[model samples]
Target: MNRITLVRRGFVALALVSLVSLALVACGDDDDDDGDSNGGDHSTGSATIGDIAIEGAYARESVTDVAAVYMTIKNSGAADTLLSVSADVGSEAQLHEVVDSSMRQMEGGIPIPENGEVTLKTGGLHVMILGIEGGLKAD
Candidate 1:
């Protein structure tokens, strides 16, 4: 019934929502065919948007108002950039990277090389969700 407990519960709820969103976006067929015959070995938990493929998207638990999301992006065409990330559970979302063990917001976005891939994981690049609604309850 204290303020701190309520805040922690809100963070937990928000993290769960973010995780579900990532899972939904990354869910797809394992048949290497992302609606195309390219036969590029696209595995399970991968979804294609245009020439961009997203795989294994997930989020970490939150004890505060911020949460982090991780994933792998594969580019099958011209190079592209990841400008930003959004989640309904928070008021702000940003692309972040860790430098010298410190976290900072990424400027100019993340680049995906042509025919290459980028992995966003802990201690590296990831998405940060902030200002999560405090009304959320764990129950």
Candidate 2:
């Protein structure tokens, strides 16, 4: 066989193997009914309190005993404040924000404008879950 033809065949074989591997990895446990596609305790859901609605809420896996939570807060009425946060899986939960490239506990809470929304995500604002027992998992 010509060298160019052999090279093409090898590339196709490699591509096929890569695709199969990806498919196998994508097939996760079906028992995860918490609507988290990434699996494990990283759950996703929505909730409403008074005039505010929290959407797309989810937690991240912990490296040690600390994890972070991300979500979007929408206000349907007057402006509101997210004073604090709590989780049963952790000893303490607090609102945190990044300021000038530094992370600190957010004092006075996060403000949500009237009829506006606030997204708490990485590198900005998020919820810190401290003293998480047994750590967190995403599998």
Candidate 3:
């Protein structure tokens, strides 16, 4: 298989593992709200990957099989492109753009200009998570 196909298969396997693990952990009361009961913070983190600084990463509580992740990607060095995104909880992850009230998948990836930042937010460019495992839980 080609590189893209291999990546997609990896994502599918990850999603399947996530689903099974989530199911195993879905037992017990889910009404606790101490912000730490879910074993990890659901909507907050920061990380620096090479010259790219990613911050404010979070996903809304998903009630369905789909969800989105919002964050700020800043490139401090040479220009780069966001080719693809993979997640452990989704079978497919895609970059999308919202235009004129319609959302569409982004092809060839999104460009990250040098010394610039891209904000992925609602009604804007964002990462769409397809086939989310057990949906996202609110924390």
Candidate 4:
């Protein structure tokens, strides 16, 4: 073959080989394993620590220096779920069941079910954190 023809053929071959390699690499990347499972992103992490799984967890306002942490403790086995909770930046943290009254109001700790959820919301029940510290976040 002529020198010019050989050079042109070599360049074309190199370009074609490069395009084929690129196509292979791109195909491998398009696999369905993008770390996003079928459920969702939030469903990836399990909420269980030891014997409790806290779900829908949130905190309350700080106007009265009191806050709450709510969660659904699900027991995977046939056993009683006795979970204890605490918080920093407070003198005393108590498990309180807030009862709404027309005239007088009351608060105290209550029992949580074995394999169910116990809500600590307004007008139902919540945790009364006494003597808050410097800063408190709802996180």
TM-score computed on alpha carbons, candidate 4: 0.47
In candidate 4, which residue pairs get closer than 3 Å at backbone N, Cα or C atoms, i.e. clash?
A: 95-109, 96-108
Candidate 2 stretches with Cα past 4 Å from truth are 1-43
TM-scores across all candidates? Answer: 0.65, 0.66, 0.68, 0.47
Q: For each of the candidates, give the backbone clash count.
A: 0, 0, 0, 2
Put down candidate 3 lDDT per residue, 10-36, tens digits, no spaces: 122111112222211222332322111
In candidate 1, the residue pairs with backbone N, CA or C atoms under 3 Å apart (3 or more residues apart, or in different chains) clash, namely none
The best-first sequence of candidates by TM-score reads 3, 2, 1, 4
What local lDDT does model 4 show for residue 88?
43
Q: Pick the candidate with the highest lDDT.
A: 3
Native-to-model Cα distance after best TM-score fit, residue 30 in candidate 2, in Å:
26
Model 4 per-residue lDDT tens digits across residues 20-133: 111111111211211111211111112453444544443332333433333344544334423223444466555555334321122322444556655544345544455555
Report clash pairs, candidate 3: none
* Stretches > 4 Å off in candidate 4: 1-46, 79-84, 100-110, 134-139
Judge candidate 2 against the unseen true structure and give its global Cα lDDT, from 0 to 1.
0.55
Q: Which should have the higher TM-score, number 2 or number 3?
A: 3
The digit string of per-residue lDDT tens for model 2 on 42-100 reads 33556565566666666544445776666787778876666666555568768888777
